[model samples]
Target: MKKEYFRYINTLFVVIPMTLIMAFVGLMRNYGFGEDWIIKFLKAWSVMLPVAYFAAFVIIPNARKLAEKITGKS
Candidate 1:
């Protein structure tokens, strides 16, 4: 695949599972476990996934740059 297509596919694969797991753990920590908690977790995950996706793309490049600077790589 082309680079743009690969980046999007990579982002989807990574972000979906990570967001789901993190959101579940975070909500469970705050709210405790229950059927209602499951519903709330799903609702929050729905909002969080897209925000995470966009933020990852924006933040990752800058983070890589900062890391390289710190290490004096390239």
Candidate 2:
């Protein structure tokens, strides 16, 4: 459990920045969102950021193991 806990922490270190980088890459094509769109996007980020945090902190690290455990896979 301790090892898994550490692994989860390590996963977040990797995931958070990677997610930010990917978001940046996506916005590269559109340097400007316009005032309204930018506000809308910022508003949406309240919901989106936590979902992303969960995925990075919880989902990604154990995803394979969880899938295998669920599917009776090795």
Candidate 3:
């Protein structure tokens, strides 16, 4: 519950969708999967399966720390 909680949440929304897009784009860029094929591959591979949180391994808690200092959550 810090000032940037909303920003953190926005990051999630953006990152997840962006990841899906990136995955599709990547598969196409790498393997030349067509749009329909990318859609199927994404459906097959699933979305937001922890790749986005790799950054959160650092970002979330640091953000929480700043948030805590400001909001005094602890």
Candidate 4:
């Protein structure tokens, strides 16, 4: 119960920053910084947030397993 929710919280923490940085860099690279950059970033964020969350949700568990294997821990 409580532990299960921990993974979701971890995912949110990871996804938000990851998506924010990626969105900013990607938009800056393609569009350049300008007055409308905030708007564009907001739009990209709306799309990327859910996508990244889903990807992380699926990928994180398997990734942790692989890490444990690689590190010979757990």
The TM-scores of all predictions, comma-separated, are: 0.85, 0.45, 0.45, 0.81
Error of 1 at 69 (Å): 0.8
Cα RMSD, each candidate: 1.4, 5.3, 7.0, 2.0
Separately for all candidates shown, the number of backbone clashes (residues 3 or more apart, or on different chains) is 0, 0, 0, 0
Candidate 3 has an lDDT of 0.69
Record all residue pairs in model 3 with backbone atoms less than 3 Å apart, i.e. clashing: none
Say which prediction, candidate 1 or candidate 3, comes out ahead on lDDT.
1
- Which numbered prediction scores highest in TM-score against the true structure? 1
lDDT of candidate 2 at residue 59, scale 0 to 100: 65
Using alpha carbons, what is the TM-score of model 1? 0.85
Ranking by lDDT: 4, 1, 3, 2
TM-score: model 2 vs. ground truth: 0.45
Q: Identify the runs in model 1 with alpha carbons over 4 angstroms from their true place.
A: none
The residue-by-residue lDDT of candidate 3 on 1-74, one tens digit each, is 78868776777776777677777676777668555785666663464536675676677779989999999888
Q: For each candidate, what is the lDDT?
A: 0.91, 0.63, 0.69, 0.93
lDDT for 59 (candidate 4): 86
Winning candidate number (lDDT): 4
Give per-residue lDDT, candidate 1, residue 24.
86
Which whole-number lDDT from 0 to 100 does residue 52 have in model 1?
Answer: 94
